[model samples]
Structure formats: structure tokens, C-alpha cells
Target: MKKNFILLFLSASIIFFGCREKIVTVEAEKNTNKGGLLFKIDKVNAPKNVVMVEAILSRTDFDTVKASLNLVTETSADLALNNIPIGAWQLNVNAYDSLQAIVYAGETVVNVQDGIITQVNLTLIPTSSGLGSIYIYVNWGKIPTTAWNDFELNPILPSPISSTPPLRCNQPKVLYDDGKFKMWFATFKYGFAPNTGYAESYDGFAWNVVKENLFDLQKNDSSSYSRWDANCVIPGAVIKENGIYKMYYVGFINSSGEWHIGLAESKDGISWERYPEPVLKANSTEYQISAGDIIKINGVYFLYYSFRYNTISTMPVQFTGGISLATSTDGKTWKRSETNPILTKSQGWEVSRIYYPSVIVENDRYDMMYMDGSGTGFGMASSKDGYTWTKTTTRPIFTLADTKGAKAYEVVYPFCRKINNKYFLYYSSASNSDMLTITIRVAVK
Candidate 1:
């Protein structure tokens, strides 16, 4: 049976309301023409005694509207307005107390698409916050508003190494340490990640690419006949673990062209050594997989990897992409989390195919920057425990149009690093949409 649950949260206030059957529909994932919405209000912002809450979902023509049951939730629950028709929507949410008094109310925009799971976290602005009539603090799956100043600069540095026709630089990992900025990128032909390059700068802006390939696949054990990543090798999340630098990379097989996660190690970010075997490999259900980001929490390593499910037709869109998690006590031996796919595509520019997640830890939250694989755009998300992420906005914070004067074809592979309290995003442009031919650029905020 189709069902929807409603939840209300606020600080020092509690409200409970109900939804009309004609106004909402809870759906199953079997529907291709519809999408899912995960609607939630921050409990800390909710009052102490909300007995009821009302959730209203209104949509446009393209997003189909059908009727479903609305169940009143008694406590904290996983919020969902599932199988919603894909289109722009308006969600009006309100909270009520035991006396049925409306203490907090707010409205926000929601966009839905089949396969894309949109998350909207609401914070209630009470009357005490000055001339406010209860506004919803919702980022709607985009970057935080306080993020960048829309500052972008082109031609920051050269490709990891020089490349010839049909081969271009792709996938970058940047780091800031000891008052210097260092970068590692890959050089690959179409559909193959074969080599890595290095660059450095005293300042995060100007960079000089050393004319060297950090590691050649032909020289590493990856070149072995039985190695899964013999065909491709892309640089991924690099982090310092136990005073030793670890690199998690994407590797592809020459025969099946399948994707796998590989490992490398370095004392410094420069010279590196590789693990003889793939650390993570795709199962029968995954079409392709690549590393997104990695962070350690309480001695456990959290590895975020982007993947596409085997069923393309069942997706909201053909290229629907999601990010999942795997944990390892020893970065080499790993196990997939039961919660796999901790993140999925959100609506707007990220409705399908979001990949290459770059993340950094700030305070207690994990901040993320991912590429919109369906289009040339980049967006942000955050997580508390490195599993469930909150997409900051509904739209991409920046896109191909944001990179001025590049006049490039497809600008992608967004790698962000925080230096001096500012985020520096480094990305490249592909002459062809398939990540061939490269021009690296940067945006600071």
C-alpha cells in the first residue's frame, strides 16, 4: 500500500497537523514517471510540544498528481513523499500544539524527478527573530549560501603532464599543507585513466605542472595481465592516515572495462607506491564504480564511492547515479555498508548522474562537492557521520557558464580544498564531452 509520513521539528515548540488524502500520494520505486521527496524539519528547531503537523504537496503539469494516504507520525521518522510526479512543487508545512494552535509555519519550493531523491531540511524562523512570519531555512540541495563569492579564474596550471591527441588530463586531487598548495591529476584517453601528473604552487592560484607522470600503469603492478585496472587508472581521494599519505583511485580492466577502486601510498604527496591488488571491486549489480571521497572517524575509514545501478531503464533517468559508502578498519580490507548509496541525485541540475565527489571535514560535518555527470555543473552537500548527506541546494551552485573566458566544451572534475578558511575548487574542461583534452581552472570562495 502507498503511504506517506509527516514529521515536525522546532526548538522549544511542538506542532502536529494532518494532510488531506487528495493532496498527497506516497509511492513505490516501481514508477518511472515519478520521483521521491524526503521532507524533514530539524527537530532542534521544533518546539517542545508539537502534537501534529501538516504537509501539503502541490505540483505542476509534468509532475503527475495522484491520491494517497497521509499517516501522522508520533516521533522522529524517515520523512518521505514518495512516487511524486517529476516537476516543480510547492511544499507548505506547518506545526500545531496540543491546543491545535499554529505556532510555526513555512513554505518552500521542491522539485522532484523519478530516481532522484530530494532532501529538504526546514528550520523555523519564529516571530522573535524580528519582522519574520515563520520562514523556512531550506538550502534545498545546493551549496550553502555563505559558500563562494562567485569568484572564478581560468588557466591555473598545466595538465598533470603533457598529452597528445585523444588523450587529456582528467580527475584532480588538490591539497594544502605547510603553506603550499599541491595537485595530482590524471592523464587518460577516452574511457581510460592511465597516468597521473603532479603540480605545486606557493599560492593556491598560480600552479606549475611538473613534466612527469607520477606513476605509469605500464610500470606498476596494474600492468599485469590479471590486474583489473590495467586499462585505466584515475586519481581519487587522497588523505593522510596515521602520518602516512594514502590515495584511493579508480581503476578499469582492459577486457571487460569494469571499474574498481585501487590504492596507492606516499609519505609525501609526491612519489607514490601502489597496492598490487584492487581494494574495492564492483559486484554483479553495479554497472560502474569510482571513488568519491574518504575520511576517517574514530579509527574507521569511511570511503564514499559513486556508482550507477545495473538497471538504467528503471532509473528516474537513463544516467541516474548515486553515492554509497564502504568502511575499513585497515584501509586495505573493506566491507560495503548495508546502507550503501548514502547519497542519490537531487532535482534540478543534478537530477541524474552525479559523480566524483570531493569532500573536506570542517568541525563536525563532512562538506562535499560533486560533479553533475548528466550536465556540466557542480553542487554541494554535507553530512554529520559521513553517511547521510544533506544536499545544500536544489540547483547547482556553479556550472559551465560560471567558468568565464574558458570557452571550453565541458568543464568538470571539481576538486575542492580549503585553505585559510576559504574553499578553492579546481576543475578542468574537456574538449569533447567524454573527458578528452584538458584545461584546468579554479574558483575561490
Candidate 2:
């Protein structure tokens, strides 16, 4: 035949132009795999209605691959997958509604390739009638009362007024009298002898360490000059005005290596009256006062301590701390808060230093709860004029995994109270040990 029909028409025109050049090489390798994955959906402040998310992919033999995404929604949900395909896969979201039920389901596991995206951020915990029930207001005024209706706040007793064993303790100070509640702490026995303890709760976590040596450095009776300084007094009671109970301690003057703030006086809470001098005195050789914390609000009296300074060294000392404020009308002549160090050190976990300031007068505000000494735990600040403050980007309300032997190099000092609507936080935890251990946490509405 004519040269075998021109060699079969040049082999059928080279198999029809090689199948038209592979039809665009199988549609451009169907996503050539340069890596890609990005899905996000967080809804904790929840409350939205249009739902219908699907996204599915699978491999490892579960066989079903249909990818091509891009679903956005601003404040949350954002998924984007392009040119995926490099290896392990298995996503599978679902979020129906419109009565088709389902509500939400998730699964994850991605790998993709090298251009980088692999995000994966999902948080969906709704389904308790679509969840919504945590609106606590507890007399939220911000504080300025004359005779009650300032919404009366001090409710904390839902179940933990007792756990037993020096299971941690801090600067708690409650004495509602005659119906009894008398609690006062500062124990660290598990970390080894930190005195000034007393407990008796008609309800406050079932305590009972009544006088575990209320200021007793092994009975240093210089003929009852009442010597106590195996290193601490730590108390901070309060009741003033005719029912007299004032306590306020921080002692450690071992012949002037200085750390004073002592002053005691009780009437029916079981004998005490040590005040031979030390109404607060580190007398600034460049600052040094330790952890004090008093409050008499409105009739004045503040205190709040923890000021340190000495970093400009010629090689004699070198410190640099902060957290000061002072003012007294008669708690014994003080004065030092013309806005003085109201709070400092900003940035995640309190930046570097902010110490034991624990005020509370809720419903008219004045929260404070310091000790972020450089964060990993304990922080909260608020004031409507306890001298200006706000701090709280959901800051460390309390952490170090909430205590156990504490660690992110521990140190905390919260101490709050509000009993009938609930909120108690007696905190303190130490690590590089100078012996600090105390704990009590409760929060309700």
C-alpha cells in the first residue's frame, strides 16, 4: 500500500498530539504539593447562628480526597488550603445546624509540604443549650458606701473552708466575730517553719491550727520583751475601732539588717500585745520595706509594701524591686502614696516586679492582688482610685499550675475574700525557698 499508508499517517499524528499534551499535564499536577494548610475556628465568646462547615480529607487508606478550601469569618473561623499534598493527611471538621443537627465535630492531623501554612486552630465547646451561663456580677460597683446597699459583697463559702494539713496558707485575715470565723494565716511548715499561724473557721475551709505559735521564735522571752525572729511574724490582722484587734507584722530586724513593720494588739482573739518599736521602718537608705499589707479604706490607713532599691552599685549592695504605697491616719504615722509606685513592670506576667498588695472592696472596685514578680502566675489589678491601676489582659489570675510545690520559680500573694456569693483566694508559694508555702483558691458567683 502507498508506503503503508504513509506509515499509518505518522503513527496517528503521534497519538493525537500526545493526547493534546496531557491535557495541561493532568490539570497542573492537581495541586503540585508545595505545602499548604490553614484552618482556624475559635468560638469561646460564642453566640452566632449561621453554621455549616464541612472540610474533609483522608488517606492512609481511608481513601477520600477532595481538597480545595478557603473559608473565612473574621473574628474566628478561617480555613485555607491550597496546593496541599505532601504526605500524612486526615482532617474532618463538621459543624451543621439549621436543624440538620450535628453541631460540631473535629479531628486533626496534617503535614503538607514546604511553603508553610499548617496552622490548625480550632476551639468549639458549645452544646449546653448552645452554652451561655457565666455572668457573675457580685455587687460590681467599683466602692463608696455609707451603710450597706453598696451591694454588700463578701461571699465565699461554697465548699472549702477546710482541707487540713498545712496544705498551704497566706495572708488571710477574717474575724467577723460572735458568730465566729476568725482565720489568720502565714504558715509554710511544709517548706519548713514560717510562723504566725492561727486557724478556726466556723467556715472558711475547715481550719483549726489555733495558735500554732503565734509569733514564737522558740519563746524568746527576754523577760517577755517577746523575742520572735527565727525570721518572721507575717501576720496582718485587722479590726480596729473599739473592737480592737489590729495585727500587722513583717518583722526581721536582727540588729538592723532591717525589715520591720511589727505592731500587735488583740483583745479576745487570744492574748497579744507586742509593740516595742517598729511601726514600719526600713527608712530608705535607698528603699527596703518588705511584705506588709494593711487597708482601712475611706478612713485612710493603707500600707501595701515591698519596695527595694540599690542597683547603682559601687559594690556594696545591688537590688531593684518595686511595689510601694503608704498612708496612715493613725495606724501610726506613715504617709507615702502621692501616687508612689502604684504598680509597675508591664508585659506578660507582670514584666519583672510587682509585689504583695492585696486590697479588696469590690462592688465599688479596688481589687488588686499582686506578686507577678516577673510572671508565670498571680496577677490582677483594678482600682477606681486606690491610686490609678487597671492591668488585666486576662493576665495570670493564678498559675504555676495552681500550686503543688509551685515552680515557674514561684512567688505569689493574692489573698481575697467575699463570702456568701463566693470568691476566696489565699495564696503564696515559693521555690528557691526562703520557705514560702500557702494555698487556698475558690472562685464562684
**Which one wins on TM-score?**
1
Maximum-lDDT candidate: 1
Which stretches of candidate 1 lie above 4 Å from their native place? Answer: 1-153, 159-167, 189-193, 219-223, 312-319, 431-436
Which window of 10 residues has the lowest lDDT sum in candidate 2? 8-17
Give each model a TM-score: 0.61, 0.24
RMSD of 2: 25.5
What TM-score number comes out for model 2?
Answer: 0.24
Q: All models: lDDT?
A: 0.63, 0.51
Cα error of candidate 1 at position 158, Å = 2.6
Candidate 2 residue-wise lDDT, 52-151, digit = tens: 4555767753346443222223443444444445666666555555564555454555555454433333333233244211111222212222212210
Cα lDDT tens digits for candidate 1, 39-58: 34434324465555566776
Model 1: what TM-score? Answer: 0.61
